[model samples]
Target: MPEENRTANFGRGVFVHDVVIVGAGPVGLFLACELGLAGCSVLVLEREPEPRSPWKADPLGMRGLSATSVEAFYRRGMLHPLLKASGVNDYPGADEPTSPRGVGHFAGMSLDPAKVDVAALPFRLPSPAMEGVMSNLEAVETVLSERASMLGVEVMRGLTVSAITQDDEIVVARAGEHEYAARWLVGCDGGRSTVRGLAGFDFVGTEPQFTGYVVLATIADPEKLRPGFNLSPAGMYLRTPAKEYIGMLEFDGGAFDRSQRPTRDHLQAVLRRVSGTDVTLNDVHLASSFTDRAMQTTTYRQGRVLLAGDAAHIHSPLGAQGLNLGIGDAMNLGWKLAATAHGYAPNGLLDTYTHERHPIGAWVLDWTRAQAAVMRPDPHAQAIQRVVRDLFGTRDGTTYAFEKISGSSIRYDLGSEQPLVGRNAPDLRLEDGTRLGDLMRDGRGVALDFSIDRRLHGSAMGWESRMRYAAGPARNDLGLGAVLVRPDGIVAWAGDRDPDREAFERAASHWFGSPAI
Candidate 1:
């Protein structure tokens, strides 16, 4: 049966679910997976009837997974399938001579892996996962959807949220004539989000500096354009390995309206101006326009209606940070929202979602804005770009850029002085050969005692169901005796000696809430 028809059966009925997620894109699906794993009933509504699009396949839809998102996937056992599907497992290391290694970029400036000093990143663990991986947008959506299905999440297609009304207890989302009720509603929809609009969020940010284009078309003369990324007086253009796809950026002060359809002539003219070549596009398959206009919601949650993904924030896809940022939002918001729905969250757990993620979103917007500023065609921007290029050639500069772009340097201010606190717990290898990531597959906080002391276990007894106890030797403890890892893989607390019973209890209470009486 069609999803729309199935939904029509639910017309005007007060069918209540634990959570109703608006949008079935990567971010929404991933959030659904997290909520389902944590035992929350989730329903996803998608505006599109089907989930396949040619533009969402490789070459045109490739997205880079930052280390933060990669670690989240690894923790949930979702990374292996993505790696296999995208063939990213073919290259294990940068030294592999026969394979193309994973390389990073900053504002079209390539940062060589050989120049990055790995030793400087003190908290990063040695893991099979690389610094980054590339996957198609469709592949990520597929993997997330599969996991969500396995976790028993319901996804309804061809359903657009037309209206939303929320009381103190629940939110009612209307799709056409049908209505669905939930304790919470999150808008994971794209930039033009209906949920955000209807929910009355203050989306404030700066305007765009350029109008970017991603095109898939056949070239009348392939030799007219260069083989790789080339920058000229007008803007920057990249002829990808796949001959059909080309990306160009023109600093047009955001004049091109994306609401209009893109034509082949417009793309060809833009290519000619940017690449300094009269590249004639014979046939156009898909064409899309974007801008560097950065914006983010003033708050992530307003009452029972929350926001995630592009609905909450948007910026230029310069470093491909938009996808990673959205995924990170889902990861950070999932556990807290799940706990709240289950009636055990602390006083401010739900509110921390915005506090923790909003700054990161703001930083990403500024980062992209900086890239746009330096990537402009003006002489001043070119001079600054030259200086950055020289800096990227150095070890410190390359390392800093790689770590920042890869999201390995993200550290939350969890009000703890411990170095490991508020950072991603190192992927420690336990004595039995089980990795810390392996233990987190079930999405539960861990009370890890590296020394087998068992004191932390006693301290964590009351919160047994929410946090699991594990004790054993690790290959490298990094001078840590015990660590408290949240389900999101963030270290809430760490100690160098025996377990700090009082401190451990305080940290556990702070993150996991008061234990069962």
Candidate 2:
């Protein structure tokens, strides 16, 4: 039966691939891309007409990408066309090219190809490298789909998954008339995930308690806008007798409805209330509704059917964390699924997915929820969250903590019991002195041999083929004394001396699928 006119049968499933990903949003597409690079054959299905919401692909600072996410982008060699495909260049005239500098330039920061190596792409590209640049949401998703297809991933778009179930060897998913099977069925679907609903998983969390406003309209000279504004949520709105401009805010469980327009008076009042400004309003090109819904699933996996990305969690869009979180979920699960499909995963490795991700999701909810709480209408509370923002923004340790919450700072509690467990390795400098970020020639997991001393002969040290172990970094971006990485970019272990081989072996077994090499 054709997808558009077909009836969906809950228990019906067809061919099974190694892995089948539901949803083609950023997370689903990204997961497919990552697994393809990991050398896992994958199939991805999407019901949406295209990626992204109706809004033009907008870019905020776009931090919150996990170290794993960075690795995927690098492996894809994905840049170039993403920028041109999604956007029509707005020069803002010759003199003001960079004026919307903050708008598009910093905006492009999210997709900055220069930030990391192109080799981090999940699959091999004909070319070894490509420079990174900003792109729209739809454009980027399209690029990822293409890259995955090139990497041998099967993609099925315009297919809405209605149900998924698991047999001993595979998970079967159905979308209307089309049925598919896979050893693993992953829900990279959005917050309203169909797979999650079928599995009867609970999405436990709360919605933002406040009504926040975000304007996606364009300004004539965005260059004049200070990056300082995005630096923090302070001074969000400025009001004039006739005009009003407010800073970006989370939906905070608030609704952004096109039908609902704030009266010029209400807009001015919010500006006075938030930014203490009173300016006239001109072209209200677009107005919509949004609410930061802070929610998380109890677990990321169930039997052969697994969930990820927005399928696993959904929260406030504050800090642009939603897409970043989904990307990280894909990265984290991609390698694991590939390993499992290859029959390398330990008996219990799959179970650890939920144990690891659930806690992190809870932590994010607590942290971001507090961030929302502090940004209340009350002055005292607002000041408090501001101080916290300031503290986290400036201090390296604190900044790392925030990064951790964003998934950048996360390190797995790998059994190594090393200081760096559950963390990321500091950027390593190659022999030619290139940053390790430069070495990620396809985002494939690498083991670096950083052995400064010749005398350390431990069991874990022997598995040199899978990693790049070399002399320790001249400086540690993570402030970690030592670092051992999981292929998905989590710290398996870090220590001042050799890690306990037995303990390290436990973690390595998960990544390498055997005892220390």
Candidate 3:
């Protein structure tokens, strides 16, 4: 651990940290890494004593990373480690823009990646992190945990936050006989978040419409079920490449007793009904159930306490948005929170975390809701599914769905009319072969000045510690002379071919606080 991250004894006995995070899951750990990278003292608390779990391993724990999420890892210099941990030797099409190999599925309907018009995506750039990867929770957590440790972020397991108390100066989390204090408290815990409830955050959303289940069982008649996603009249069932893993969705209106462990008989019955085949489950190794019950905290913050990941919003794992959405929340909030912690943030900077992320969370919840509505096992739903299927058949329609699922369509309303101003800055490369991702590894905002005269150089030096300045002719300028990217890879501002130095300085001051004396 670094000297800066060490706990400081404020008084008689109380030790205070800069930020204390709950739930040492991927989101929590990732946020900790970001804060630590910015030299903030961070401590992460987890209820589980151990990190490993069967549910977080391969097959059952499989997850999809959106292109945007992959880029986040790339920016932080964790892309190669993440891909290696996920068992992928190399990602295809690193040097040039290309359509993705998979666009994932919608309401159990698989999308054809070939139909995705890569040319239609906004400011699409070719880079190593251009495409998404198939990974499991274990791999993601492992990579993040290692990086967090490297950044001097502390993780203490087997601590469950029982209570939370806060004031203007600091927040305290009580777990059993121990109390941990920090200037800020962030809840990255999952759906049944104790911090959210303790902090008085009002959660609101719709109820569940059906019960979904994932099971690992020995199938006596494996041939009875088709491979991959299967949408039936009764419901849907997915048979993965791993023969033992099975996923089924039944329109039980969320009435199935998920409290009790699902038995072999029940699993077989649900499988038969959903698959419309008498598939036999000889032995059930493991099973878990979920629902399309979409819910979200009305606000992400209450005083000194903030929430991220599933702690802020939750919905069905339809379209595999849970992990990616939580990752987006962490990436978006990390640097902003760090800036505020360092006491160099502009007015209302922390507030922007909620303003920016809440809408994205709501959109994800509604996205799952739409999928649930179209997969309700009714004539109306079937009709709608047919319509959606037809839409998926079109090139433009596939591209649209691809945009949403891959998170390429997301453009934060940064109050800028410039097309790329609020979007994730493409991996703009310089003639010297330096990419934007390489420059962001230190967790500082970057000013890419591509003007011939290097006009923004002197202005960028005012806030040297808060931003990195790189100047050169870009390989592809995307019609812009320069772009100011926030530490989280968001394009804060952009300049035309002439390049305005005043506008660039204003953007720098606006995001990085007043220029240093």
Candidate 4:
């Protein structure tokens, strides 16, 4: 069914959307695009009227997309636009595997890209999105917003969701005198989320260890601070290529009052203390404060209202995991939520969103917590930092960190003993030059049969609307005859030398409901 036809008027004057998303940021916009692509009527409400903000552009808003997050864009056919908007000329080495161009920092310690053993990584394949990208919040949001608009997603700006009321069948969000009704609601608002509180979700996590600051100011003495990430006995400070842009971390136990805008004098004092240099700030242009106060909702979904992005989990921007984590959440939840909204989802499919994602969220929170612990300005932390630094100097250590930071180590426990079953399906290419990413653009599960007989043809046909079947000899089968990938690119099942039709059908039915007549 078309998305336009999905919007229905419930008698009276009320029209119910398939999903109403709060916050038009990257996560919300990406989710909206997914739902819209699945032919679901989506309405997005954003508290900010204007999409453009200084904090969302250039150095301040700069963020890193993990390799997995980059693949999500490629799978959805948005990679080129995303790269173009991000000012990247082109991503090289799509046809051949290579070492990652960069391995982002852990805490304040930067990793050497050359030390990452690319061969040791499992299930990796040559593809355009094999590497991560450096992008800003603005560029990411712009790409998703454009896609969402094309898919008929309605985004209402300057609307704050003051109240949320949900019954068994529908959810209504009230803003001022107006109300928007939808079958489901999602909160993608930031860390201080109003939707998370209004929906009555229990948020629990540790307190802040340090107060971090990102400042764009005039450095009177440009050479006082060293370029790149610097860890001192006091704390850590980062001086980027952008001369005015600076990052600092102070272990005052997150004592810096974030409520009040940081002043030039206060920023200078903190900079001097952390950098151990007499650096002066002539004028402070843009400044924002964050803490290592990691927190996450006890549950992502509270009845008809769900949360994504920073609304669901928050930690310091230590390894740039927050954005990537949220994007992963949206990708995983989008298809399941869309299927549920469209009424074809298998039993217990919606529940899998939490089951699959909560652990990943918990891991990220702990990842940042580990970084914070090592970055602390204490003797015990310093001792651990020395050991960690020594470990990071090794090939094995770099490879391990690469796996985590690149998001390649994530594997959902799908009750399968097969190692590949729960991992992200690599860009498996057929002998005819077709790629799995190409086949997944339309948001549907995919069954790739590498057998010469094309054995799963009939079984795949039964769920044609929910799954795409492609059969051929694989360029590199990775020791598998067949693989079933979920709509979100997770490998649901894998087959051996000779694929079994019954097993494929069972996996198909498990993920995509019963077959069509």
Query: For this target, which candidate reaches the highest lDDT against the unseen true structure?
Result: 4
Candidate 2 per-residue lDDT over residues 1-517, each given as its tens digit: 1222122233444444678888777778778877777666688888866555645345321223333343446544553344356453541212111111221111111212222222322221122121123445666677787877788987777888877767776677878876787777888878778999997787888956645555534344343344333322332432112122344453234644535776555544443444433434445554544456688888888788889877888776554456656766776777777666766666776777787777767766676676566665567866675566554444343433423432444655655555555654444544455554444445544444344552223644644544444444333333323445666656565544443445445555666666443
Alpha-carbon shift of residue 267 in model 3 (angstroms): 1.1
- For residues 1-517, what per-residue lDDT tens digits would candidate 3 score against the true structure? 2344445554526778889999998899989999999999899999999999999998899999999899999999999899989999868846999989889999999999999998899899988898889999999999999999998989999999999998877899999799999989999999999999999999999989989899999999999999999999888999999999999999998999878888889889999999999888889999999988899998899999999999999999999999999999998888888888878889999999898989999999999999999998889999999999999999999999999998988889889899898788999999999999999999999999999999999889878888999999999999998899999999999999889999998899888999886
RMSD of each: 4.1, 9.0, 1.8, 1.3
The RMSD (Cα, Å) of candidate 4 is: 1.3
TM for every model, in the order presented, reads 0.95, 0.70, 0.98, 0.98
Q: Write the per-residue lDDT of candidate 1 for residues 294-330, one digit (tens) a residue.
A: 9999999999999999999999999889999999999
The whole-model C-alpha lDDT of candidate 1 against the native structure comes to: 0.86
Worst window of 10 by summed lDDT in candidate 2 = 96-105
Candidate 4 regions exceeding 4 Å error are 1-6
Question: What local distance difference test score does each model get?
Answer: 0.86, 0.56, 0.91, 0.92
lDDT of 4 by residue, 1-517 (tens): 2445446655526898999999999999999999999988899999999999999999998999999999999999999999999999968746877999899988789999999998999999999798999999999999999999999999999999899998887889999799999989999989999999999999999999889899999999989889999999888999999999999999998998889999999999999999999988999999989999989998899899999999999999999899899999999999999988887788999989889999999999999999999988889999999999999999999999999999999999999999999899999999999999999999998999999888888878879989899999999999998999998999999998799999989999888888877
Candidate 1 at 283: error in angstroms?
1.1
Badly placed stretches (over 4 Å) of model 1 are 1-13, 91-100
Clashes of each: 0, 66, 0, 0
Scored against the true structure, residue 125 in model 3 reaches a CA lDDT of 92
Better of 1 and 3 by lDDT: 3
